[model samples]
Target: MPSMTEPKLISGNANPTLARSIARRMTMHRGINTNLVDARVERFNDQEIFVEVYENVRGEDMFVIQPTSNPANDNLMELLIMADALRRSSAARVTAVIPYFGYARQDRRTKARTPITAKLVANMMVEAGIERVLTLDLHAAQIQGFFDIPVDNLYASPVFALDIRHAFAGRLDEVMVVSPDVGGVARARDLAQRIGVPLSIVDKRREKPGEIAEMTVIGDVTDKVCIIVDDICDTAGTLCKAAETLMNAGAKEVHSYITHGVLSGPAVGRITNSVMKSLVISDSIEPTAAVRDAPNIRIVPTAPMFAQAILNIWNGTSVSSLFDAETLGPIYEGMYSSQ
Candidate 1:
């Protein structure tokens, strides 16, 4: 429903496949014919970023698709420069369609003398002439408040719900939704409510930012099919530990559904050796070679939901219906509710 008169699509080097898929769904024309200029960024001898945009976007409502995933700093700078360039070209509005918004985990100051990098990223977007933001499942939902412009924080749980329902049709009564850590209890609870299952939480302690100390599960997972729901899975420590804990607690099967797969360091190997049956992740962050090669790692597409959201936003309609449990079709409601 984007205004056919002045809409334009642009993308950076990051996740061009997703951008192209979104463009295809929007135009129904096998992707829009927008140019993707090579942002030849380099260090200025002093290790500073230099960016340049090669396309003209005058009077257009431009949507720049860029995921700040791996090499996040470079991708973030590229997106900022694209926004700035579009604004300079007299674009009507610039939308930063970042599937993965980096620095979101640092939304607040958990310790003394730590900078709130998420707020800093928001400020940079504002300064770079970004009129709006479209991101999927930020680590901290509060990060949406950092932006001055309207931000759409999309959820991947609904999509996951559909797949889960289809994959585990008659086994709903044996399913249990779990949070990998205590802090993610709210997210898991929301998913469990929508899926109509019992909710459980993994009581975990983090000794360091990228380290997991101990994991103790709170709810009864005995002989139950467990599904761990989390916003992001980086390093895979927390997820692996939680899976191990659930198995130790007598879980019959363990599956993980993470929004962003930031699989870093030994994540793939850890998941390979862990007790999790499958690790389902969204296409918000581009999959790595290791993730693609892992037999247990499965990917669910978010393009349909994102495309529908773009349609809703363009037509100035309500997007709240997307999160409603009833509207997600009867197959999911019956399957998940019984579980």
Candidate 2:
């Protein structure tokens, strides 16, 4: 149950469609007009970001739905500025509903003179008057420690698992999960255990940050329907390469479910001409024209999940159970217990 004070939903340019979908879901649950709040989030002549709230938000719980993707800096500024505006306007509480948290990949300092941008972003959010954060599928789970306020990090696996389950329903035994790199083994293993399948890893060496080396399949994938699970797919080189390696190692089909589809550079082009069967991404970062036009790409809706999460956070309820295998309604069915 939502609180008596209905929350205000605001949107930035990063992902307006997702924001609107979330608002629509909120209205469906609350039975009220919970559309996006009237606000002006625009840029100035000098490319300065400015946010002006048109409607009254005094003492109302505010939600800023912004995903810092593509043009990360501008979108990030919009979130900070919006939070500042809401705080200045005397909002009761401000929660940042960021579906795709950018700069999360830089959670740690891998080398000297490198900055932990993830922590910096967290600090910036708090300094801008954001009281809490609600985001999905962060690149690094440990980044939550960087935030001073409450951070609810949701997983997109449940949404993805439902579709995966349907695709492999009676043929679940032939399926196997694979993590393209060592970093995603936990994510892959979770899904593997969920659907009762084996796990595989793609062991590859990297010469540099943007350069990938030859990959080797760490586990057997003979005659298996391999499901590659990952967080972000920026250039998608690793994704496509891993799919090829898996197929070469005798995988019947290779399907990837990535949480955030950054899809920069020639990502869509590579995916379009890759050996992978399909690449299913969530509606986290607003789909670009290339993404929408991709032949083998699919999108799964996560607005309802986010809307229910917002409602739970507002009501001070358990947010973890929403991803729980046994508790998440008929979507999980009988699988997802070990995870």
Candidate 3:
């Protein structure tokens, strides 16, 4: 960096493995002796969170990595407190790297007397000293408008497209991408177009919470290799059901590529026993023991992508370039260069 102050990375307790992987990729990309900022985010006896940075960050550009996943409230608190700490320590800048942005689903009000928690979170981050936000695959794109600060939302389509190409190389002609519901048609269409495959949608309807969801296929999946695309896979109920619907409609096989694997409750069990061939999720959220042990579950590393984004942001380069397919190829390929 041209500046005398070094760029610093600080991570919270959420998804430490992903934070480390991103740090490693940053090392490879920058070719400098770089590491995460020495910090501790622990809980007190009453479960109160505490964050302390063990270094001088005066005038340094600070990047805080914390994904508000399973324990959304705790992780969110840690992020806010860390940002406050960095600002108080005289850090020149503080950018929030939230791989899996929690409360994204609550972007809109579904019923009366409901709050848009996504907007509230954005307000809280800004008030807590966050200058910028770097997130991946938000549930709703419009969440960006909620933030008054600059928000760079990254997509995982290119990474997933590369894996889909490599995994279904031999049967490219038979592959077709399926969106689990009408709400995901755009995401599914993007992936389908990237790989030059057909597109389908599952019309999902639910009467209310805790009720069984009904799914109906929109396009022909007969004798086709179905690949379901979605942003978050929470319980895997809808995903499993979508796969079953495709199979019942005469699909040759079924697979899924989800960005955030918020695999809570009986998610692992459902995917394991479902008709889907495999479930591919990004490392935005840390995997649980059951998730790792599941035979049908696979994780795709997003460190290289996040790492490149971080570098571009630090260097004042074009982060949007990474979204371009032609530009993304080299970075994704570069990931294997180190391995």
Candidate 4:
């Protein structure tokens, strides 16, 4: 039986900084010396991933922090292997903490003969003996149905709402939340509601993969500063084109707050040269050198929210309360009040 104590945190090579940050927050929140379980993840000569848990995890609750980001295959394999190792080590329960769920964009098939890799990933995790899953802002909410075990899909809206409030405290009236595409209107509308702003949508057509055909602003954005919101920003093509269209529609400025900054391809270059006033993304995926060097890019740390979620899950408390913007508003306001 597992002891009624703090959960053991093990980190993969995917994003150690985020893991460490979560550990630190856990320690502070519990007022105890919470430390990461020592583990070595190395590669063989042939580049096969190897994970060895150094400490005894028998009868302990283990939470492995690994984001399936860049080199998605490698990180995902590491997570699967680590879960297997922990299960074999007699861990009572294993929770896979995947901050950025890779391959989630393929939750459904747009055409025939397409594979739902998201469901495949979920099956792999279950087969690897993951008792639960903790992730942030899944590309599709329905992806939760892919897993049989408990899955907590944490949202970044609370975090983004706080940042948006701080950045435009006195002039929120001039702000408008925009969904870069019609599909993201719900996500953008949530943020807009939280921040008490009107919502707008960008009607876009994609001619091919990773390319935008046309973008048109759906709602009135005249003279208002637009803040485009979405779950992920991959190539930056859509975001850039939307910003341009919004500008042409008489918007004063365009900014963006995305949950996952999967800034792949020419994303950094596009954002740097685009007309966006600022682009803020959560550090769900570890920022690359190019991302960090981008002048218009800012990364919001997600450790605090993830840390709280982990703590809640371990304690068998309700994690849904964490998503309550009303409750989180005052807390975040106090947190950034001095900054």
Give the winner by lDDT.
4
* Candidate 4 Cα lDDT to native: 0.91
How much lDDT does each candidate structure score?
0.81, 0.89, 0.91, 0.91
Q: Output the worst ten-in-a-row residue range by lDDT, candidate 4.
A: 330-339
Query: What order do you get sorting by lDDT, best first?
Result: 4, 3, 2, 1
lDDT of 2: 0.89
Kindly give the stretch of ten consecutive residues in candidate 2 with the minimal lDDT sum.
330-339
Per-residue alpha-carbon lDDT of model 2 for 1-339, expressed as tens digits? 657787889999999999999898888877888989999998999999989999999989889999999799999999999999999999999999999999998999998999999999999999999999999999989999999899999988777777787777787889999999998999988888777789999998998877886799998999999999999999998999999999999999999999999999989999999999899999999999889999999988778788888888888898897786444534333333333
- Inter-residue clash pairs, candidate 1: none
Can you write out model 1's per-residue Cα lDDT over 207-326, one digit (the tens) per residue? Answer: 886677888889899999999999888899888988989999999999999999989999999999999999999888888888999999998776656666665666667776667535
Model 1, stretches more than 4 Å misplaced? 1-4, 29-55, 325-339
Residue 110, candidate 1: C-alpha displacement in angstroms:
1.5
- Global local distance difference test of model 3: 0.91
* TM-score against native, each model: 0.89, 0.95, 0.97, 0.97
Residue 31's lDDT in candidate 4: 90
Backbone clash pairs for candidate 4 read none
Q: Is candidate 1 or candidate 2 better by TM-score?
A: 2
- Per-model tally of clashing residue pairs: 0, 0, 0, 0
What C-alpha lDDT, on a 0 to 100 scale, does residue 76 get in candidate 4? 97
